[model samples]
Structures are given as C-alpha cells and as structure tokens.
Target: MYCDESGFTGNDLLDQGSTYFAYASVAINHEEATEYVNNIIQKYKLQGGELKGRNLLKSTKGKKVIAEILSTFKDRIKVGVYHKKFNLACKFYEYIFEPPLSEKSSLFYQIKFHRFISNILYLDFVCRSEEAEKIFSDFQNLMRKKPNYLFSSSETPDMSPLDDIKTFCIHHRDTINQELNSLQGTDIGKWILELSTSALFSILCDWGKEFNQLKVFCDVSKPLKENKELFDVWIGIKDKIYFDFFQGVEEPITFNLSQEVQFVESDKFPGIQIADVAAAACAYAFKEGVNQNTESWIEHIPGMVIGKSVIPDESYTDPNTLDATRNLILLRYLAEKSINKQPLLDGIEEFLSAVTHDLNLNPSNRIATIAENSRSDAPYFNF
Candidate 1:
C-alpha cells in the first residue's frame, strides 16, 4: 500500500476546524499509479510538477486531477481522519511528559494546576496576534452552521486546519516552543504529533495482516529523518500502547504492520502523489460535513472498508470488511481508546466522556462514560 498524509502538526490539534490529521492508503501498486499518472499528464496536457490535492483542489483542472487520480485507484483506498481537539493535545501532552513541566489546566477543563498557563496558550494561539486572530476569525466564519463551536463539541460542524497547522508546527516548533515552554519541552508536542500521525494507521495495521506484507510510500514532510522515526515508532507502538485496552487480548496482536516505509518527494513518486490527492479529497469530504467520501470523492475507496473496534483487544479480522462506509464509528472508536488508557490519558474525562457519549457512535452501548459511573482513579482536569 502507498500511504500519504495531508495534515499533521505538533500544535494545531486543538483547532476543530483544521485538517486535524488524515492519512490515506491505496492498495494499488506503483506501476498502476504510474500508469494513471501518465494518463493524467496527457489528459491535462503538460504538468511539470507532480499532482497534489492541495494544488489540484484549487483550479477546475486541478479538481479533475484529484478526481481522475482517485478514480484510478477506486475500491483500493482507505482513509483515517481527525479534527483533533486541542484539549486532546493537552491530554496527550500531560500523559507523555512525566511530572509535566507545569500543571495543565483548561478554562473549559477541570484541572487547576496550570490554569494560568493554559489561558495564556489559548490567547496566544487563538487571539494573540493579528494574523492569528484573522486566521481564527476566518475559521469561525467557516463554521456558520455551528454556533460558538467549541471545536471539541460532539454535535455540529467544524473547520479543519490540521494540514496547515501541522505543517507549520513541523517547520516552527522551536519558535512556538519558546512561547509555550511551560508545557514540558517541545518534545512533548512532537511526541503528541507522532501519536496523531501514527494513530491514523491503526486501521491499516489491522487490515494489513490479511496480506503477507505491506510496503508504504508517503510524501515528504518536515525533518525527514525525524518523521521517519516517528512513523517507525508509531507502527511499533500500537500493540504496546493500546493492547491492554482490548478485552480478550493477552499478548499484543502481532503482525508485520509494515515491511518497508519509503518517504519520497511527492513528484518523485507518482504513487505517493496520488495518495496525497486521495488524502486531500477525504479531508475535504470530512471537513465539508461529509463524514465519508461522497460526490466526486467516492471514486476511490469504493471497496470493502474494514471495521473499527471500539475496545482494546478487538482486532480487524478478514470477516469484518464491509462496503465502503464513512464515519466508521470514529467517535466511539477513538474515545474508547482514550478512555481505556486512562492512567496515561491525563485524567481529563469530562470532555472526553461528553464527546464520546454524545456522539453515540457505539452500536453495542458498551462504551461507558464517566457520567455513567464508569470510574477511574485518575485525577482528571477538564472543565
């Protein structure tokens, strides 16, 4: 499979109206992708650069490029998306850094330790400067259907800025770090980012077991070496980090999650380039209130979509594959994962519980929120 990501930054996770983070994988071979690329180049009549969804989604011709590329790999694509909750970043930050640099707080969260710092971050990130304010204002305007969108809300629409934010953070973590140093070292930001980026592939890992081996190609992102390390750790840590959350699991689920991971410039690899286009299309579909691919986006990923398990021990067996379905019960699947890993979850379940419960994405009603008296010993801090 050729895999590529659209948005993933160390900081933009808190913005609900961002790309959040999205990864797309296609089962098509490089040769096939290459054939499609050639057809697109000829059809579009000359393109010096490789095709990308970001570039293509702009012009009418570009949209066709996205459509054509997706059509070539229809039924072979799988995508995972997230409009990360900023609170989620705090939770992850708290969880990763031992004796967190400072206490973590949310005006909307219950924690009291670092309330001051939390407020500072919010102001700096959301309202600090003119550019930031303008960006945020534009984002708010984009969310016309949802009022006072807190972003982490369970109901309503949001604007996604994950791609831009993530890309920005990757390039400017040091600069942002100087201002937000109270939250442990900037490394926490990077690790949290690793989780979001890698987490996107949980389904891919579950489904790859059906095949003998998997080779993944992705477009280059900032700090190539570090992104490579993050990707590797992400692939290996799933079972280590999430196995205990499952019910029947003893030893972690074992499989060759990936045999080879190659990061190439988008234009250099037609396969990775098309994967980019597919990812962007999924993000557009998701951000536009279309949870799953529809309209011009369904040309890809039209085949069986594997099921997602809400708990820890559950694995995607070959039988779980179903017709292409979006929304794939994302809220429950992620919330349960967060809930089950409570000790490492930064003890902030109020918002987690609210979003997870309100979404009601779980079919079995097995997801027990804190409100339901599902108890844990962690010291939660969300408002």
Candidate 2:
C-alpha cells in the first residue's frame, strides 16, 4: 500500500507562511505485507504483537529498533531526508534565532537556506533506474515465496491465513504526534515527519497503477482540511487529464477520494500507492507555492518529471526552477553576511539572469537591468 501526507508542519513563523509539505508512500504484496507485520512481532517478541494489536514503537526498545529497520526499506525514505533538510534550515533561521554574522538584531540579514537536497537525491535514484528495477524484481520474488519460508516452524503459523490482499494508506500524523508529544525537542518530530513522507511516496510509486486508473481512500483528519488547497489543485489537474483522455467515451475512470473503505467482494480497488501521489503533491506544492488548492498545479506538472532533473520541459515543469527561485529570495536575505557584498550580489544577478534567459522571458534585458539596479551597496561604488 502507498501512504502519504500534506501540511504536517505548521506555518513558517518567520515568513508568516509554511515553507514545507511532506508525503510518503509504501508498496508491498500480500505475502511480503503479512510477513512485514508478522516480523515486527517475531523480531521484537512483544507480549501482544498480534496482527490486530497496536504495536507502537514506544512500548519497547526492541520494537523501536524493529520499526527503524522496517522504515529503511520504505520508498519515501529519501524524500524524507530532503524534507528534513528543509525543516532544519527553517529551524536554523527561526527557532534557533542565531544572530546575523555582522548584525546583532537585524533579522532581515538572517540566512534563509532553501533545501533542495531531496530533489537531488530523487534525481540520483531515477538516474540509477536499474537499481530500482532490481529492487522491485526482488520484492516481487519475495512476495511470491511462501510466508513460512522466512520463519521457523514455531513462527510459521503466525503468518498463516495471510491469503487476502489488503492495502491501507495510513497517514503517520497521529502516531508521530503522539511520539513527539513525549519528546523534549523539535528535531525528532521534524525527522520523523520527513521519514514518513518519503516512505509514503515510495509506496505510491510501487503499488500505484497508471494515472488513468487511480483512486484514493483516506481517513478524515484536520491535516486534510488544512491542506485543502493542495488537494484541490491536484484534483483539478486530474480532472482536466481525465476529460482529455476520455473525450469520446461516455464515462471515464474518475479520480476521487472517499472516506468509505468498504469494497464489494468482486471489487478490485488497486492497492494504495502513496508515494506516487505524494511525489505529485510535492511537485504541485513547490510549483504553486504553499497554499490551499495547490493540488490544481499538479495537473499542469507531469508525473513523468518525478525522479528526473529539475530543468523544465514542455512535458514536465521543473520543480528545481521553483526551488531555485525560492532560494534566490532566501539568498537576498543572506547578502549582508558577505565581506565583499558586491561579488555576492553579482553572483546572484548572474544566476537570475541565466534563469531568465533559459525561461525565454521577453524583456530579459529589462529584468536583468532591474536586478542590476537592486545592487546598491557595492563597496567599490564608493570611489
């Protein structure tokens, strides 16, 4: 099953807006899925590690260890790392409230670092597509094997009656929040949320079907309401695609979310693929800026761009461009840190100029001139 989330983090107080959204997805077949849950019990040997029991990580140290082990295998883990970097950068500027290098009270001089490491990691993974294919092949093989094969005879019965293929798209908000509430620091919460988002994205890519045939089932929660803007953007995009794809058909495969989890016996709702949609959501979040109805931007941005370079294409919007743009704004806030501010300003000007050229913006000269004029405090200009 795939799992993902949006708006886990509260708004950015410094910017008076949220700077990050996170999502995670995971995928597993029936046998592997059963084994995964069962292994949690067997590995930890918990008193009540039965399938229906709530085996939270806090209950036991062994359980925590087991949870971490399982988390490493999740698809969204890398994406989680990226989100963590962004969150850390935000905290460094806001919560840490570190004084500016040169100025004691000038908050405007504080660095606003834009964390795009997650995108770089994603691009690296996709560039190494062969590895993904190999891992997926191994997963399928493992799924087909008998459940008992991985366990001793004493533990074999625990995995029996695992024939039914069930997929659940669980948002980790409640669990993470519960864990964080007991903790003393904000860093762990940031990391946990990042991990959850990455895992959700991974699940989506593995279990999700083609965009033409996809449905999402979710539990009603506050985060959903908080992130309604993002959802709306994505749904709007999906609707346009659906209309285009089924122009001649009387009815087309529609994408919608339902709170109801019930499905008829014959009904085969494809397993949840949270990472696929989470990646799409992240793409949209970056494109539309952090706001409600950000999901509408998802339709305009192609899913083909997932795990690809940040350079924009007619088919795929470059999330890197958006990230870079955000970073430029942040850099302006950091400009006062430089001993030679002119050189720093020049670098920023050159980078923005290149981007404008690449975007084919008409009146690029006018924009560059404005950027040039924005550089007023050049030390050499004193002569």
Candidate 3:
C-alpha cells in the first residue's frame, strides 16, 4: 500500500495549469525485502569505498566536493552514477545553499547537502523494482561503459523501515527548503510536502496486506467537460455501485479523488492543463489496474466500463495511459490474488444504462464547456 505522487509543474501552488501531479501505490512481498535491499547496498559498497556519508553524483565535476569525500573510502565504497545530462552542479546549487555563502557557511552547507544527496540516492534505489530490472541493468551497463562519469555510493547504515522512510522525508524537506530559497516565485516546500504524503501513501499500499482489508477508489475525469455526458455514464455507475456495496462498512475505505484544475488564463484549453489531468488520471488508472489483480474484494474498473463518459478536457494522451489500460486487462490472469469480478461487471452495466437514460432526459445540459473558448492552437491526440 505504498502511495507516492510526483508533480510535473515547477511551482505546485502558484503555477496553475502548467503542473501535473501523479500518484501511485504498489504492493510488494515483504518477506526478506529489507534484507535484500541491504544486501544490494552491501554489494555496492564492497566494490569500492565505505558506505557512510557518500554523495550521489560524486563523479560529476560540480560535485568535486563529494568526490573528495568518497576518495577517503576509495575502492571500499562503490557509487552508481546515472549519466544523463550531467546537471549535478546546477541541481546542487538549486537544491542546496543560498547565494553569497561565507566561510562560516561550510558546515551548514555540508549537513544540508549530505542529507539531500542521501535521500535522492535512496529514492533512486527504491524505485528499482523487479519490473525495472532491465532499466537498472541497462543503466549499470551505461555507467560501466562511461567509467569516468559513473557515480556510486554505499548503502546507509541499518535502520528500521519506518525510520529510514522518515529520514528520507526529512531530507526531502531540507532539499525543498533549499529550493525555496534559491529559486524564485514558487512554493517548493508545499510541493515536497505533497510528495512526502504521496510517498507515505505508496508505502502503506505496498504493505496493505498486513492491514485490515481496505478498498481504494479513484476518479477518472473526462478529457473535456462537454464530454461529461459521456463520462457521467461511467461515473454514475461507479458511484451507485460503490456506495451500495460499501455504504456502511465497519472499517473505513480509502478514496483518492483527484481532479485536475486548469491553471491557464486563456479561454481555450491549455497544454499544461491537459497534461496535468492526463498524468493524474494515468497514475490513478495504473494503480487500480495493478491492485485489481493483487487484492481480494478489490476491483479495477476503467472509466470506459461505464461507456461514453467524456474524460475531462484537462486529460491528455500519455504513455502511462496505455500502460495502465494494458495492465488492467492483464490483471485478470496474472494477479496472485483472486477477486469477485461478476459484481463489478454487473454494476458497470446497470450504471451505464442509468447514466445513458439520465443524459437523454436533458440533452441541453449534457454538454459542458471545459474552456471559455473552445478552439485551441494546440495539437490534439487521443490517449
């Protein structure tokens, strides 16, 4: 039950339509998971230098300070570097320290910098799930090929899972603070807080089996408001069935109701607005798809199950959407847990008919105008 969210927008608060938020929850077997991770960390450390106080991008030029620290550990600590744009220097300054630092600021800078780097490294490690083994292998191979540019680090000292997670959040908070001071006109702090919240949610989802049975629900809006008529069919069915099925459960269920609010000022649909909604929708869809197969008494029903529901105008086509769709269909066969699919399908059909009847009764109000101006210069693509 691990849930996490990522914002595509630079400023989550001020920047309205340009930002996107993505939330995901994954469940993984816990038996020996921590030990496995620790083992991986140890293996990484033994190849080179010591594990304590290592920087993420040590090999990068801007992080020469980090390189120096690692030099002490030598071959005892092994650092894994991802050679992308090599923007470590920019990110370092951007995520740590204010301008015009005096000699006295060295200690302050070091503390903040180490915490930030450690968290980033930890995240990079956690995100490497079995599904991403190929990507990790490829990345490792790339690092091997570019020997000079590759960076690596030893694992953090042993700690409980909760403690390690809290440490990660605290470091994230420090990094966000640094970003707030160095960058202008944005509430990066709030964004990080949201990320932390989302991350905690993901962690819970990952370990959901340990908790009492919980049902998680999410919404998928239409691409255009006018398409609401189409979207309503599915939404209506879901609402009816969900409420009917779990109207008064003793245990509370979790509902993740996310709506993409447009930030653009123009009457026409903005690219940013569409991108944001689309990203959130995809994240929700993917999580549902994955969990549908893995959790008993949990169902994964796509908005399409209701039929003709117009997704919000803010929703746009993205690779994640297709991935989510594919996963949902595959879950029927690949999931380790068994679910009662008949109720879900029956609910879908009933809701679809009811919604279709309602739409027909009010043709004029059925269409919704998502934007003040309908036309846009932006290119349109289907998800």
Q: What does candidate 3's lDDT look like per residue over 1-383, in tens digits? A: 21223333322221323222343332222233234334533545433222211222222331232233223222221111111111121122234322212333343233233223223333333344331233233333322232321112132412322123222323334343453445333333323222223323333222232433322222222122222232223221222112212224222113222222212221122222222222233333333444432232112223111111112221211112332122222222111121221222224335444544554564432222112111132122112
**Candidate 2, residues 212-243: lDDT per residue as tens digits?**
32333332333333334433433323342222
lDDT of 2 at 357: 65
TM-score of each: 0.50, 0.29, 0.22
Q: Judged by lDDT, which candidate is best?
A: 1
After superposition of all CA atoms, the RMSD between model 1 and the true structure is 13.9
Output the number of the TM-score-best candidate. Answer: 1
| Model 2 residue 207 CA deviation in Å | 8.0
In order, how many clashes per candidate? 27, 33, 44
lDDT of candidates 1 onward, in order: 0.45, 0.31, 0.27
- Candidate 3, residue 159: CA error in Å? 60
